[model samples]
Target: MPAVQETVDQVRRIDVDQYKYGFETKIESEKAPKGLSEDIVRFISSKKDEPAWMLEWRLEAYRRWLTMREPTWARVDYPKIDYQDYYYYSAPKRKPTLKSLDEVDPEILETYKKLGIPLREQEILAGVVREDGSTPSRVAVDAVFDSVSVATTFKEELKKAGVIFMPISEAIREHPDLVKKYLGSVVPVTDNFFATLNSAVFSDGSFVYVPPGVRCPMELSTYFRINERNTGQFERTLIIADKGSYVSYLEGCTAPMRDENQLHAAVVELIAHDDAEIKYSTVQNWYPGDAEGKGGIYNFVTKRGDCRGARSKISWTQVETGSAITWKYPSCILRGDNSRGEFYSIAISNGRQQVDSGTKMIHLGKNTTSRIISKGIAAGRSQNTYRGLVTAHRKASGARNFTNCDSLLVGDKCGAHTVPYLEAKNSSAVFEHEATTSKISEEMLFYCRQRGLSAEEATALVVNGFVRDVLQQLPMEFAVEAQKLISISLEGSVG
Candidate 1:
């Protein structure tokens, strides 16, 4: 008899739902229908019960965005985006004031449970279970899916330090005064094309404030996921560190695989007052379409920070690996005497993905200093670029800036580019920028493979080494997870 064959069929594996906070809510959400118009903008404002001034501000931004043209200079090719085809507002079908977590709807809790983020850390630690068995690690969390902020954990602990960590929606109703003062303070509404769109029809995001002389004890976090396909995600985040305060905030994003490309435009602003320090970190893993480049998200964002007072410090660290099109530059302004700024980033694009990103540092205060370190990795047939700017204004006496950017191409099919712009008008300013690009060497791979590692393992090892500098910059609790995410996202088609 011929040898019998054992066969296995490809199990159309439903998405693994790696992140515990992966479930969608059920409600008649408050949404501005698909389209962009003055009516839609006004509708969003009215939905939020925003005052008249905000409505006028949004109108101005919309007008500015109309005058601005879509930027085509990036080394990216994708279908043109339609601004009108997206919902300007999508909120959880809940009252304006569900003041407490327990007041949340049961459906919302189910969404959190499905995503592995339980309502309270204590509940999670007690092992939240279902008819089937699964749970997320007992970490304090705030889950934001699509356009709504679902849940937040560790609220009392954060509140004790005079820190406000909540969804922008709640903050709008509870702390509108603060939101009105600081919203769009750093990255103005007319900043860029996507920013104006975000301003006009922005949905919900995290809002954080650290009052004067307080030191935040725990890390503040926001987890964002895109659930609805064919929808654009426009979120706005504003963080303010009051005088003599300190805080460390982190945000992560992910999206599902869909056939049609989705647009994600967001704005993040950070402000640090005298003797304050604000550190912001992001690990973005949006769906990067597929190997054949069928679909993915277009990520265009504006992130900037202002060190508004003397001796303040601000730092930004990001690991970007998803999206069919990614274009952003998180920036910093040293406006006060002896202020400091730093940026460390690692961006990877695979398959047909494209990313053009980096940071900008402006020095205006006496003896202000800044540093920029960036690593770009390109794989498959993707295109990746590192574009940055470092400037020292005329009044920036004794200013100093150092920028180092490096690129690694994993295959012959991909392309990498670097464009760093530096301008210095101060006589006392000193700056240096060094950039280089190289392909991952086969010898390095061979050595790792000889040590009994699989191809994927070997590749991950080398790429990890290449990005070690940037990885080391992440917060301790998040560094390991971020590195693992980078490894998995950077694998495949390394030839």
Candidate 2:
């Protein structure tokens, strides 16, 4: 049998509810009082030893959150989340500072190891050599466990290249000026209910700044893990690329299985200056509850990027296959002349999951261009939606946009939806949108079966082909992992 088909068959044999990342890390943790009061916010801020201004910022966001209502416009149904019933902050009990990975808690390190994260720099770099005797590309990782960053590797190496890579909490302390200038500049604290809550109580996330005229020597990545029960994980990420610089960032997330839903509300901001470029990618695989959908994550996230200088570019690529309820949109603002933005997504839902995700492109400068391609796959009584918006402002003369959304259904009980909005305020602007919905053809399945493929394997093969376009956009290693995940997510849908 072909290797790919063999892998598919192996994955199909696993139980549908056996999420690979469902194991919890047993470690003593420190947590704030249960609830969403001003006092809880103060406690979190004080725990981080944040500046008074930062505290005031959180207070302002908390005040605003009190008046704001949770959005209900998305095509999803869920029980009301009781903010006061959950712990706002949770982190492993550890020393305030660590000099190396050896000092990190063994259980936490083992957790990341099980998740296939390379925290030891020397181990990852060793034995990694090409035929020409050149070292292969390396990835600097920021491992965030629950509410705090457990470790960030390759800090000294990144500093040599004038790239600022660290935890956001450290950035606020070390580079306050930069944080103050750009934090919330793209997605403000008052952007939405989830973002506002994140701004108020977010504990830790990755921060990156690349200097002018330099390309980052390696990929930067962050891995987030939620382990504590009944606790919400709120993280904030920010990246800035100065003039003539380039950086590629990757994000990965997971959570342990539980009987009650947990909350994950995160905010990410990206800024690119003149001639700079930023590529961001995500592989989200949080636990999506059992086959009956008894427990899972409510992932409400806001991510946006800004082209702040002429000729800048920002690209987003994501593979989402988890979460019981996912409400996210990664968008871009082309604010500089000749700027460009792109979004490529592959979303797969199974086992009663609900996903509503897409992107927005806003052109505000002359000659700005944007493109969006989204593919959604639904199976096992799931609901998947693709909602997007594209607009060209009055001043955006010569602006152009192209958008394509496609959905695939694997079973009669599943559903897929597409909702796109487009607007052009200038006569010189042009926009095009295309969408399609389809299901697996019986003839195709018959052909595969005749070729010695089982029903589940045939379905996986067809689904892989359906999402090949978006898969091509991901990094090489990520694409392979995503392909296997796609097969695993659809294991029981066909049989």
**After best superposition, candidate 1 residue 478: deviation in angstroms?**
1.4
TM-score of 1: 0.90
Residue 459, candidate 2: C-alpha displacement in angstroms: 1.4
Candidate 1 lDDT over 158-266, as tens digits, reads 8887889988867877898999999988988887788888988787788999999998877788887777756778888999999999988888887767778888999
Q: Candidate 2 at residue 197, lDDT?
A: 94
Task: Give one digit per residue, the lDDT tens place, for model 2 in 413-487.
Answer: 999999998889999998998899998888999999899988988888888889889888887777777888888
Clashes (backbone N, CA, C under 3 Å), per candidate, total 4, 0
Best by TM-score: 2
Off by over 4 Å in 1: 1-30, 94-96, 99-119, 124-140
TM-score, one value per model: 0.90, 0.97
Top-lDDT candidate index: 2
